[model samples]
Target chain A: SQQGEEDPQALSIQEGENATMNCSYKTSINNLQWYRQNSGRGLVHLILIRSNEREKHSGRLRVTLDTSKKSSSLLITASRAADTASYFCATEHDTSGSRLTFGEGTQLTVNP
Target chain B: DAGITQSPRYKITETGRQVTLMCHQTWSHSYMFWYRQDLGHGLRLIYYSAAADITDKGEVPDGYVVSRSKTENFPLTLESATRSQTSVYFCASSETGNTIYFGEGSWLTVV
Candidate 1:
């Protein structure tokens, strides 16, 4: 199975703080992507980092990928109440024909 | 706006019945996918189509069927639904198989 496993199944933080989630997969990947899902809502794409790329940033979200370790991390800085959501890490393998295997996700709660 | 959409946002069906969840995308993407979300499993792929008339099974394709007769539409059908089939089904599409756009999802209940 190429499924990614996310550490810290749940995280709670106060507003203006940072939240970090990690994902690890056993298989080689072409790219790793992060998504955010609010309760009862569809997932929204956040960031994508290729295997060759070690790190990328999008607004308040920062993603790091280490192919040597087969792990990735997502960090959201200065989180707000509106940023509370479930974060998922999906891995796309080079041989998968674009199929993405997702992790169980990290449920983040930002309190005001 | 160009986006993906799904039909039957919510449905409650009985066992041994047939249910079809419809998915349509305006982007004319060649890749379309069907995934089911559960409490602890996150999202598991059920079926995927690379193009019109080209469909393949995913990790959890059993008890589910999918057809893509048109480039903009792909529908997932469940034959002889079971209680375990109850889940939130999502339809997603991608233009170049990189970034995926997902629909709101359909909540299905089989009793």
Candidate 2:
């Protein structure tokens, strides 16, 4: 079963603009991670935020976790065309032990 | 050669036929996972192994079987291929509590 659900199933934005995607999960989690897939091939790990962390950043990617709301959001600043891909949010439940349940995903298209 | 790879990038099989998708990782990560991606369904874990000789089922393990006899290899088998089993399969591995790396994935079609 899918424990996480991403909002804005699809988003189209112009290059250089900022894009934000939100995810909501059903249960308590130890950490939340975001992954990017281009052309449905392989998935690349974007970033991860622990339950105790309210926000984290890597390059242009920013991730925020709200444990109380069971939700997380990914923000990509100055989005580039190369950043166009399907982004998924996965939650590692408190007791899952290395297992991650993924959300449907958000397809972001960055237009040049 | 330094990362994860999935064999038989594409496969076509008939119902009742048995097919296998192979995954090999050179990182020697203790944790390996198998997940299938389908339209509107996202990716669902099929199975995972914490270490060689130990494996566990995930949300959707109905027609699939996984075996991890070695730390570098994990193979997923379709006992009885069916149309519903058609999907893209991804293999991933990670250190105990680190970021996971994914293979290119195998596209399987059941006719």
Per-model TM values vs. the true structure: 0.98, 0.97
DockQ (C-alpha based) per candidate is: 0.62, 0.67
Top-scoring candidate (DockQ): 2
- The best candidate by TM-score is 1
Cα lDDT of model 1 overall? 0.92
Off by over 4 Å in 2: none
Where does the lowest 10-residue lDDT sum fall in candidate 1 chain B?
A: B93-102
Displacement of the residue A95 alpha carbon in candidate 2, Å: 4.9
Cα displacement (Å) at residue A44, model 1: 0.5
Q: TM-score of predicted model 2? A: 0.97
Measured with C-alpha atoms, the lDDT of residue B41 in candidate 1 is 56
Question: Model 1 over residues B9-100: C-alpha lDDT tens digits?
Answer: 99999999999999999998899999999965589999988899999999999999999989999999998999999999999998554898
